[model samples]
Target: MTGMERMQMDAAEYRDNQPEAKSAVGEAYEWVESFLVPLLAFLLIFTFFARLATVNGISMLPTLHNGERLILQQAGYAPEYGDVVVVDRSITDEDAIVKRVIGKEGDVIFIDFASGEVWRNDTLLDEPYINEPTMLQYDISFPVKVPAGCVFVMGDNRNHSLDSRSSDIGMVDVRHIMGKAVFRFFPFNKFGGIS
Candidate 1:
């Protein structure tokens, strides 16, 4: 063959012998889309939108037990009456505490230790979720008014919990509330939405 024909044939052979370049790039792109993107999304969702917390004590017994895993909703969460929440250690020297919001800001809370009753804003609470009556009295007195940007918290296990009624952890500030417990995921059998 002529020199030009030989060069053309050599170029054609080189092209034919090489592997497809697009396949490698396409695989890399697919890996990012299928694995990396989803992993980042999952991490972001778990970090900002939700969090995992474990119940540490028997304070929330009957409603939540110790060692139970909970999923907390952090984003756009506002504490409401009767909502179970996790509080950080801003008000106490201990670690995080979990309790139910008994009263919100500006609400008057009165616990009659003699009668084992709790009254909020002069309304008697229908607390069927409490493990027992409010017979255990802490240092904080009744007829207390929840200040602005604060919440009164209590444990379901009334007699055992050291909560807002106690002076050590009295009146949790709104800023100290980490998140609201939205679901229970551990123990497999008890997996469901937290009430």
Candidate 2:
């Protein structure tokens, strides 16, 4: 055989012996298309729609506990009374705390420490989620009206929480809110939607 023909024959043998090389590259491209790209999209969607937070203390005990994992939804967030929410603590403290919205702007809130009854806008506020009586009155006096563009929030564990009732946390500005606590995802036993 001629030198050129011999080289061509060798090249054909090499190609025939290595059938997997082409398939391996095609499989890699398929994996990138099917898995990697979708995973990246999923991550972006997750981060945009929700926030992940860990319960840092027992402030919301009996409802949420320390080290528990939670999902905070950020979409179309409007602060409403009774909604559990995650507040950004930069304006109040070093770390954030989760609490339930008790009153909104212009809502008059008053607590009777003796009876443990909360009054809002002259009506007795019905609170079944609180862990205990509202006995923890802070330095701030009550019959307080939540300021314009602010919200009154309190922990479920009222006796142990520093919340809107306290001067430090005050009325949380709507801007300082991180998101609404929608679900608990950790501690498998407690995995479900939150009120």
Best by lDDT: 1
Error of 1 at 129 (Å): 1.5
What are the per-residue Cα lDDT tens digits for candidate 2 across 130-177? 899888888989899999999999999999999988888898998888
Error of 1 at 170 (Å): 0.3
Worst 10 residues of 1 by lDDT: 16-25
Pairs with backbone N, CA or C atoms under 3 Å apart (clashes), candidate 2: none
Off by over 4 Å in 1: 1-3, 14-19, 90-93
What clash pairs does model 1 have? none
| Candidate 1 lDDT over residue span 74-183, tens digit each | 99999998999999994446789899999999999999998899999999999988999999998897799999999999999999999999988999999999999999
- TM-score of model 1 vs. true structure: 0.91
Candidate 2 C-alpha error for residue 133, in Å = 1.7
Report the lDDT of model 1 for residue 8: 100
